[model samples]
Target: MNAVTRLLRDLVAIPSVNPRLLGPDVETPAEEPVAEYLSVLAKKHGLDVSRQAVLPGRRNLLVRLKPSGKVKKRILLAPHMDVVPADDSQFKPSISNGRLYGRGACDTKGCIAAYFHALCQIAKYKQRLQHTEIIFLGLIDEEHLQSGSRAYARNGPKADLAIVGEPTRLQIITAHKGDFWWQLKVVGKAAHGATPHLGKSAVHQMARTVEILLTEYNDSLKEKQHPLLGSPTINIGVIQGGTQPNIVPDTCSIDIDRRTLPGETENTVRKEILDVLKPHGLKPDFLDLRGVPCDALETNPALPLVQRFMKVARRRRTLGADFFTDASPLASAGIPAILYGPGDIAQAHTSEEWIDLTQLEQATEVVKRFLQEVES
Candidate 1:
């Protein structure tokens, strides 16, 4: 097997699932194993490896390939180590029909493996490195709020480019969407269900609010379309209200997920929703997301490095996806970041998530070529 494939298999063997954040007991967040494992690999490959404890017991690993005492460009290679929870039956990695089936196979383990393979290939020619420095950062908590990326970006070494690993089928992604989460609460007086006229129903009020917000959301989609990223979207992912079916409930709540574009802000989006509900006498609280928001990533397509990479791929057309990634945090820090890697995003977070072996190999080759071009 190729180095990338072998690395992917190794990554799959390690189950680094994110702990439940809202369980009965506070699940201690931990991701040390993955960090330690990556560190070991980096050391074996003769690269300087380091770890940062971004959270208690959770660490981010950084591996660097310094230039051969020259002034080459710098590139940041980043992949999230923590994977979302996997079903009990899907904990182990299995290969079938040239596809690797596992929890993080499509979401990011594939990218991790591909990146390592690329790095391994580059190591063979370390003496030829011109003026480039490649830094590989394996982060934590991307499945939740992107804590690792935020922390790393806050105190990270400056780099010219950041290639965030995701399941992009090896496409160079310059744009995607951002995320905004809000929890809304509606209050009303409770009364018996039979006393229909005697009580105010919070559920009924929330229904009106939801209706108006959906209308506004749909209207905004028609306003303008981003050249790469099409449009912003809104999804009411959760709704809860009432106790007994007959009682006029006094409280109702909804969790909204708003997908934004490059120029959109949380305040502006929240204001649009609030405006829709204000006139209806439906007041609700907007909650802040506990983690980092995945902002849209837009890199200069005309950059020398980007253009060179594209030439290596020999592809004229690129795509923009709707998924959010760690690229946002890195981009916000003034790093030209892009989302690129192997596997289909459609399979991510699915019960039967898998990554094509061919895609993984292709991605590894792409990473190696891009690094060599910039490094040399």
Candidate 2:
């Protein structure tokens, strides 16, 4: 097997499922194993490695390769190490018809394999490069709240440009929609189900709120559309209230997902939500909680690094993704970042996830070429 294939197989075989998807019975629930594995691989390749602990027993691993001459630019290869939960059988990677099947085989492990191989080759040919710094960051909790990337962006050691590892079918992504979430809660008096008139129902009030969001808010969002990203959108993901059918619930809470466009911030979204609530008499108390807030990415196509990557990869089209990525946080921190990798985003988080070996090879070649091009 090739080095990239072997690396991907090893990564797939190890169960580094995100803790949020599992119960408390798991002994090791974070990306510690995968982080350590990549760390050892970097050391084996004679590179400098370090870790920034994001959570207890979980860390974001960074491996670096320094050039011989003065560094002109720094490029980061960021791929999340954590995968969504999977069954025990899924942990054992199996190859069939030139495809590797496993939980994270396509989502990002394929990028890890491709990036690592290219990094190894670049380090081997370090003397050929004039000036450039290459870094591979194996981030944790990307499938969750992206806390790893958040911490990395907030803390020290920033980069000039970055290639965030996500399944883009080997395409160069210049823009993608933003992801933000809020929790709406309605509190009311509780009473017996038989005497419904004695107390108000929070669920009823919440239903009206949901209708307003589903209709007015979404309609208003459609008017403000992004060029690459179609329109700002919202989805009611989860709703929980009431203990049983026989009792009036005192509280109803729902999670709302808002996909924002460029020029939108947490405060802006908050105000928009409040405006939607005001007409219906719903107060700010309804939207009292917020989830991991991230911005949409809109990199200038004329930027040197972006143009170099597109020219090196030989891809013509510039597109946007409906999903979110770690690039948003990095870009918010003043670093030019784009999403590019092997495989398709469709296979991510699927039950029988797999990545095409052909695409993987193509992506590997692209990474090598981009690194050399940017460095030169």
Candidate 3:
């Protein structure tokens, strides 16, 4: 098998499922095995390697390759090592009809393999090029709280530009929507269902709140449009209320997902939504409890490094993704960041997840060429 194929297979074989957050049925954290495996790979490749362990065994592994002399520009390549929970039936890595099937294959592990293989080739052909440094960051908890990326951003080597690894189908993604993830709780009086007049149903209140939000806030969001990203969108991902059919619900909770644009922040979106419900006499508690907050990655497409990458890869056009990535923190730190890698986002997080080998090969070639262009 090719080096890229072998690397992908090995990565897929290692289960790195993130543990449930303080649940009664919690599983052991899955980020460690991937970290341990990458550590050995870094040593094998003779690259300078280090780790920033967040939990006991889980760590964000960083591997760096440097030129012999003084450097100019630093390019950061980041790929998450963790995967969302896989179906018990599809956890094993299998190949059929030129596609590699497994969890995280297209979501990120494919990008991991592509980046590593390209770096291996670069190490083999070490020469005096323009690039000062190339750093590969295999991060943890991206599928969970984004703790690894957040930690890396707090204490990371400064770089001129960052290329976050995700399934972008070999396209150079210049922008994507940010996120305002929040939990909302609505309260009401509980009583027997038979006495409808005595009890105010929290579920009814929740329905009204949702209607007001969808009618007022949702339409307003559509007015602000991004060139490539289009307009912001909102989805009520989860909602729960009454305990039993006979009981009037005392409280109901909902999870709202708000996609943000370039000029938007979480505070602005949160306030606007709450304001819409004011007329209805609704007062719901909004909490930003999710440890991982999604901030948008806004990068200038005209950066020298980005231009070189586009030219080397012969990219015809640029686009934006609706998915959130590690690029946010990097961009927040004033470094130019882009989400670009192989595989399609559509195939991500699916039971039959797979990536085309041909696409993987093409992506590897692009990475090699892009590195050569930057370094040479």
Best by lDDT: 2
Q: Could you list the CA RMSD of all candidates, in the order they appear?
A: 2.5, 2.3, 2.5
In order, what lDDT does every prediction score?
Answer: 0.81, 0.85, 0.82
Instruction: Estimate, for each residue in 185-291, the C-alpha lDDT of model 1 and write its tens digit.
Output: 88999999999689999999889888877886568665858888888877888999999989999999989888888888877777877776777787788777554
If scored against the real structure, what TM-score would every candidate get?
Answer: 0.91, 0.92, 0.90
lDDT of 3: 0.82
Ranked by TM-score from best down, the candidates are 2, 1, 3
Report lDDT (Cα) of residue 37, candidate 2: 83
The superposed Cα distance between candidate 3 and the true structure at residue 168, in angstroms, equals 1.0
Q: What TM-score does structure 1 among the candidates reach? A: 0.91
What root-mean-square deviation over C-alphas does model 1 reach? 2.5
TM-score of 2: 0.92
Write down the TM-score for model 3: 0.90
Locate the minimum summed-lDDT window of 10 residues in model 1.
20-29
The residue pairs in collision within model 2 are: none
Clashes of 3: 1
Better of 1 and 2 by lDDT: 2
